[model samples]
Target: MDIAILSVSLNVHSTKRIVEEGQKAGHYVELIDHTKCSVKLGEGKPQIYLGEENVTDEFDAIIPRIGAKVTKHGAAIVKQFEMNNVFSTARSLGIMRARNKIRTLQIMARKGIPIPETLFSINPHNIGEQIELLGGPPVIIKLQEGTHGSGVILAESKKSAKSIIDTFYKMDTSILLQKYIEEANGEDIRIIVVGNKVVASMKRISDLDDFRSNVHRGAETEAIKPTAKEQFIALNATKYLGLGVAGVDIMRSKKGPVLIEVNASPGLQGIEGATGVNVAQQIIQFVEKNGHRSRK
Candidate 1:
């Protein structure tokens, strides 16, 4: 099987690991930078190419190592693969929805998945009332599209919340105001779910005072097995998002397990290192089991 590892850099850890694992598994794997690829639509289907080189249909699957900011173009390349009958770990629609926070949270709530009680308003008229609904002060305000703890703000007071909301309103950016879970203790669980199995998990602990638990934000990680309810939340979130593999982030709230978000292209470094598990191997085996391929 020939596998195309779609990523922005072949030097990346997860990208390198998956490419090496696929090679060890006796599959022909090519690392194609999605940023350098383009899609063309024609009579029967769409075709994708890296520069002038046409991507072949013989490839078994595309493991998209897409970044959050490039969700649109990155998933566009994956969608082209779909048109040519090539498979991906995540479908285009799934990728798009997972990248959009408010949409993802709404879909999860609709599917009966527990998440932070969040409120959104496009109209500035509802800002004041929305803050009241969120129970005032120290709420979580986040941009519709941000990752790695970049665009999230902890509004510690009603004045701060008002200021942030007003700023976003002035900038014409939609934002979500969520009730902050105090007991989360600057920590959260990152569960890697492949198919019906929870492959690995890491409890990411942030710095003493920060709200974000991302490793890039000086957070530390330790391997921890999720509870039954945490497992359920992770699995159901992945299932509802129509993803074959996911990184399900959950917080241990007083109300029970609250799912924070589900990531389609989750980083493999921290989880695999903390757990000493072969996450890349698991992902490759999953693709081999599920991906569509044609005779060369």
Candidate 2:
């Protein structure tokens, strides 16, 4: 099978792992920097170009490892491939949907999937009322498209919450407020799903001074088995998002496990190291099964 890993660089850890694993499985794999890709339309069929090379039907499938910074352009490249009857592990729409926290939560809420109490409003006139809507302070403020725990903030008091939210609103930044789960104790779960199966899961514990449990935030990790409910949520969340591969982040609140977010291009390093699972190989195998079929 021929496969293309749509990413910014081949040096990235996740991209390298996928490449190694794909080669080990005897599949022809190549890395295409989606940021450098361009699409030309209105000249008969759409043409996808990688610099000087035209790449319309170059592969049987694509595994998009799209970065947050270039999500819009990356998704467009994937969309072009999808239009040309090439199978992709993630749909372009799913990438866009998972790029924003508010969008993901909205879809989950509508699908009967459990998520934390989240609120988003562009109105700065009622900042206090918005905070009150989530039962007052000690809330979580997050940039809609933030990654690696960089744009997450914890406001421990009503005054601080109001000030922070107001500042973001005034700056014209997109953000969301969520009820913080103190009982979580700086810990969260990341479940990796591929092709309707839960391949690996890990518990991330934050540094003493931080509340975010992202591995990029210097958090410690350990492999763990997800609860039946957690697994159910992970699989269904991936399905609802229309992604064949994803990482579902869940937090335990007073009301059981509530989803925090779903990652369309989940990293393989932390989860593989924590669980000792060959996640990259799993992704390749998933493509083999579906990429062989006619494109839908």
Largest lDDT belongs to which candidate?
2
Can you list the residue pairs that collide in candidate 1?
Answer: none
Over 125-219, each residue of candidate 2 has an lDDT whose tens digit, in order, gives 99999999999989999999999998999999999999999999999999999999999999999999999899999999999999999999899
Evaluate all candidate structures by whole-model CA lDDT and list the values in order: 0.87, 0.94
Model 1, stretches more than 4 Å misplaced?
Answer: none
In order of appearance, the predictions have TM-scores of: 0.96, 0.98
lDDT tens per residue, model 1, 98-145: 888988999999989889889988777666688889887779999888
Candidate 2 residue-pair clash tally: 0
The TM-score measured for candidate 2 stands at 0.98
Per-residue lDDT of 87 in model 1: 77
What is the lDDT, from 0 to 100, of the residue 159 in candidate 2? 94
